[model samples]
Target: MAWKFETSGLDGQCELFGVNIFKYRWRDCRETAAVTDPHYGVEKMFHVYEVEIDGQLRRFAAGEFSNCVWGFYLEQG
Candidate 1:
């Protein structure tokens, strides 16, 4: 199934790998294995965001692990 992304909210900063990264939330951000077609199945969902590193704003998605939020950067295009 094709993937779809949409911005949900701009929350705040989160620290990862000794640096502060901005947090963004999306409606359909989740683990690849957990997701099916958006119209067909119920899957785990998370928040997506963007961060500025070295003067470049990069996109990311947030997921919860062990009660803490984790950030995963999206590929640049």
Candidate 2:
């Protein structure tokens, strides 16, 4: 299913395994996660986001990370 993410901002950032990682909080403050594992020379990163679907909240993570663009994904349980 497609996701609709609210506005987000960087809450923290760090480096691990020589890769830069970032932490962010969603607008609701109930969903948050970090992004790492750069793709295309750090132009693309990966992250998992929690979404509410069918009156239930779920986590999903399936997408690339862009420097100028922010996308959403659900984490696998």
Candidate 3:
């Protein structure tokens, strides 16, 4: 999927790849260790969260930079 960060509504809310994350019930947000990109060497900190959607538990990783939030809708295989 083409994951792109987009702003939603006038409240300064955000969505990942057009998914309205707030529509689901999320909890258990935990911060993990920072990681550096192997190619660019850019270090980033992430928070892992669990959200129940359609009776399935979905995981999400979110990070912030320049006051903008970016995240991954971690699809389990």
Best by TM-score: 3
Worst 10 residues of 3 by lDDT: 1-10
Instruction: Give the poorly placed runs of model 3, Cα more than 4 Å off.
Output: 1-18, 29-41, 73-77
lDDT of 2 by residue, 1-77 (tens): 33333223232333222222243222243434543333332322334444443455545443434454434443333
Sliding window of 10 residues with minimal summed lDDT for model 1:
1-10
Write the residue-wise lDDT of candidate 3 on 1-65 in tens digits. 22222232322365543457766666756655354433355766556678776677666655554
List RMSD in Å for every model shown: 9.2, 11.7, 5.9
Could you tell me the lDDT of residue 13 within candidate 1? 47
Whose TM-score is higher: candidate 2's or candidate 3's?
3
Q: Go through the candidates in order and give each one's C-alpha lDDT.
A: 0.42, 0.37, 0.51
Ranking by lDDT: 3, 1, 2
Stretches off by above 4 angstroms in model 2 are 1-32, 41-49, 60-68
The Cα error of candidate 1 at residue 68, in Å, is 1.9
Q: Candidate 1 clashing pairs? A: 24-48, 24-49, 25-48, 26-48
Report the CA-based lDDT of candidate 3 relative to the real structure. 0.51
What TM-score, over all chains together, does every model reach?
A: 0.38, 0.28, 0.52
Prediction 1 global C-alpha lDDT: 0.42
Higher lDDT: candidate 1 or 3?
Answer: 3
**TM-score ranking, best first:** 3, 1, 2
